[model samples]
Target: MFKSLLSDRPGTEPLAAAFRACRTHFVWAAVFSALVNLLYLAPTLYMLQVYDRVVPTGGLTTLGLITAVAVFALACLAILDWLRGRLLLRAGLRLDRMLSSRILARVVDIQARSVGQAPGSQALREFDNVRTAVSGPGALALFDAPWTPLYLGCCFLLHPAIGLLTLVGGLILFTLAWRNERDSRPRLAKAIQSNAAAYAAQESVAGQAEVVRALGMRGSSIARQIDQRRGAVAQQADAQLTGGKYSGAIKFVRLVLQSAALGLAAYLVVKGEMSAGSIIAASVLLSRAVAPVELLVGAWPGLVQARSSWNTLVELFAKTAAQDRSRTALPPPAGRLRLEGVTVRLPDTETAQLRHAVLGLEPGQTLGVIGASGSGKTTLARVIAGALVPTAGDVRLDGAEYGARDGDELARFIGYMPQSPSLFAGSIKDNISRFSSATGLEAAEVDRTAVAAAIAAGAHEMILRLPHGYDTALGPYGAGVSAGQAQRIALARALYGDPCLLVLDEPNSNLDQEGETALMAAILGAATRGAAVVVVAHRAGVLARVDRLLVMRDGAVQLEGPREEVLARLREAPPAMVAAGRA
Candidate 1:
């Protein structure tokens, strides 16, 4: 029955899997926590013994023995508490070891599928909240809460009236905590949303700082960010105020209950119905019984936040897990690229980005795609390189569907350069090698590949002229390099490892005439080496050597065939029409 219950809980399977991997530590920590709670009764028992047995009978030996036992119990309690903390720390570390990599990979996958629309950093932050909550004092308080009844039972043994009063106090505090959660949850959620909006605003401004400054839009942007931040702060303040009210009520009620229990016990003593020892013990036990409830009230906000974070992470994991289950491994591609009726539909519009784009290229074939701006050339390039999946139809390599292969593995054999080239904070060699150490490649092999790719891209001479040659480090986005230099180095990276498929988008956008010649040569060289090369460009000069041509307009192919035939057809068309097609 317990197994069935566990299986029925959402998110529990993954959580339990992690716990099982470190079950020994968890079990020991739990045992120690239980022992520590049990030892908590020692103080109350010692007070009862001293007041009733030692003081009444003047028994010094009895007092000495009781004191020694009380001290020993406390010492044991300290040791158990330390051990429990250590065990929990180890469990947290083990959980991180088991899940962090999987979570990070899933985040990357989510980002790719969403085309960077999703807030991946927020998702990662949520996961971190879950981990911290699991190892935090709030979790320990929750574990100890169940033992509240035991302490109350001990109070009942002292006197029924005291126990009943303590129970009522606990119920009141619990009610307050429930009210706090119910009232503040919506407010907290709104605050979180506002915070995210504020962060997004800041990120947008930061990314376009140069534009903001150039257009004198800094003031307006700052105002917008401030508005978002103000909303977030206001919502947070409201939530805290609501929670504080309930927290204050709980604390007041707890104090009253403790004093009332003591007063009632004293009244009973005066009436010869109870002893003084009973009063002291009853008060102590009542305090212990209600401590967990007090702790819960105080930590209630953080607990709620953690619960929300956990749910978000579970949803993300579930989505990623489904994707993983449907994916399969396939043999490496052999440069035979085919697109059968491929279509790409934008999420926010009715028009398709690419419509029934059917094309094929065998080994050693070079295809040049030319289109006007916003004619879907970049989209086609992305789809061909597997950066964006087609909305309809199939992308195949060697007669096998590209979707069948893992995305990362497929990416390894395909070289892609986007319109705006980007580089990480690494040396030129590392960028060209794609940071191959991450793939466990040896240093010598990485160096060989980097040097070869640089030469193939005609970047070797330029790179060598730099202060440190290939060892020179570049800042984010290839800082310290000219636009032409960055483009060539990016080309080098795309050509690395002699990938079977090459997709270059606007490869000459920032290149000089010399660099353009080098790029054209590189494309021809790739085709000669039995690679299937696809270049998307607006320049006719870049497409002069292509064996085939595809001219796209309005997301559909308007002209396609052998280069000579396409060029001949274009020549016969009106000059105005040809210019419009280019536009």
Candidate 2:
């Protein structure tokens, strides 16, 4: 675990490798820290010489020379501090350059895999925390912390009494830091969890705002969010209050000890045991001795947070690195999809999600899948769309097994329209031109293809009626358009490239009667263009125009035949059986 914190570069081990690559910077920063701490002695030494030599002998020339030397030492100290800061800043930038993009890709991949079940955005925030804390006060404190003993040794050389007091003060500050960690850790952890849950809830509501507002539940939704986060807010407040108290106590200790060193020196001077300059000299050294400890104590929270973020990132990267990175790209598929004994199982259970399911589609074939909820229709659709890989079977396109890199190339040939309109923030033209090339083509060629796709989906007139037509801007998840409108736009996207494999999961769920007619026409039109299409719907009415029908139950296909044969069997079945299967 600790080894990861010491490595360099961002290649496979992004965090560790980056740190290792910046090792030179860390070494120079440490060297500068040492020089700065040593130069700090100049102030104490100058005070000792001035009061003992200049005041007692009244030597103006000697005082001037020593003062100049002290000023030079101070100047060098300031320069070293600045150089150290620059080193750390550069290291931070280097770390970011190596890790940020990798972290972002991992975040997106995690979200895509979980289908938004996991709040992966939190990982990006964690990356920010790590970067900030690494180059912020906590890291500086780390470099300075090891010099505390050297500072204390100097204090002892001045006077053992002064050293003892500084040591006691440092111990007190360290104790308070420990107490702060103990006091804040639980509440802060709870607060973090609550905050994540609240954010996930908000994303959920925002994604379904159309449904929530249409049902007049907007007020209740806000109330629900507030209630969910009340505990988290309370926990965060309590943690901050406790941390503030400890920090205040640490400052109080450092201040009191510095003054105490001065008083002790004054008493010794009064007894003729030391000269008057000893007072200031002892005080300065004592202050320097405990300052590093005070910094470490003050930066305790940031140190802990950075450590946590590092560990989290390490684990995430470790998992990702274990997977094969090399992927082979295959040729574009010819619309022949064959699934043989495909199986998908729950991660923690023996129960299968898709059990030994076999299906096939030739070019121009239209298959409608019908099943009740939990009957694996969505899972099958996801597998066919290459969104999810099968656990124990082969999913082949044109006799080629899908490789990791092949997915990207295959994407150009597979058009998947999920039940929820999967749209991004962009112009309608950009969204419809999913596979359109931006360069090396006539501007008219790209626009013409986008418009052609929209026209084929029966959305051309609707788009033209809008203020910007194909150039209209949209928000997340096809926002800036109504549900039916978004659905039509999505269909256009799926039909954009005239992809050989088209998979739509409940594509007509949000459509009106006229919209439904257009959708049916689009499906038939795609098949006429030699694209193999699979449509999943719970109701048979929407699938009336399909060439074949497949009914699923408990993750297995229960019935499959030509469309007419399947419908006739469903009609002749007993009413109870028909309702049970929802066929």
TM-score for candidate 1: 0.93
In candidate 1, the residue pairs with backbone N, CA or C atoms under 3 Å apart (3 or more residues apart, or in different chains) clash, namely none
Instruction: Estimate, for each residue in 334-442, the C-alpha lDDT of model 2 and write its tens digit.
Output: 7998889998874555688899999888999999998778888989998898887677898888887654444446677888889888888889988888635543656
lDDT of residue 346 for candidate 1: 61
Best by TM-score: 1
**lDDT of candidate 1 over 1-583, digit per residue (tens):** 0122123244335655875777787678778989999999999999999989999999999999999999999999999989888777787788788878767777776665556454444776776676666677776787788899999999888888888998998888888888998999999888877887798789879877878999999999999889889999999999999999998898899889889988999998898887889888888899999999888877777777777777666666665553455565667777999999999886667899899998989899998898778888999999898888777989998888876777777778899998988887899999999898787999999999999999999999999999999999998778878889999999999999998999999999899998999999899999999999999988778888999888888898888888888877777877743653462
Evaluate all candidate structures by whole-model CA lDDT and list the values in order: 0.84, 0.81
Worst lDDT 10-window in candidate 2: 1-10
- The alpha-carbon lDDT assigned to residue 574 of candidate 2 equals 80
Q: If candidate 1 were superposed on the true structure by all CA atoms, what would the RMSD be?
A: 2.7
For all predicted structures, in order, the TM-scores are: 0.93, 0.86
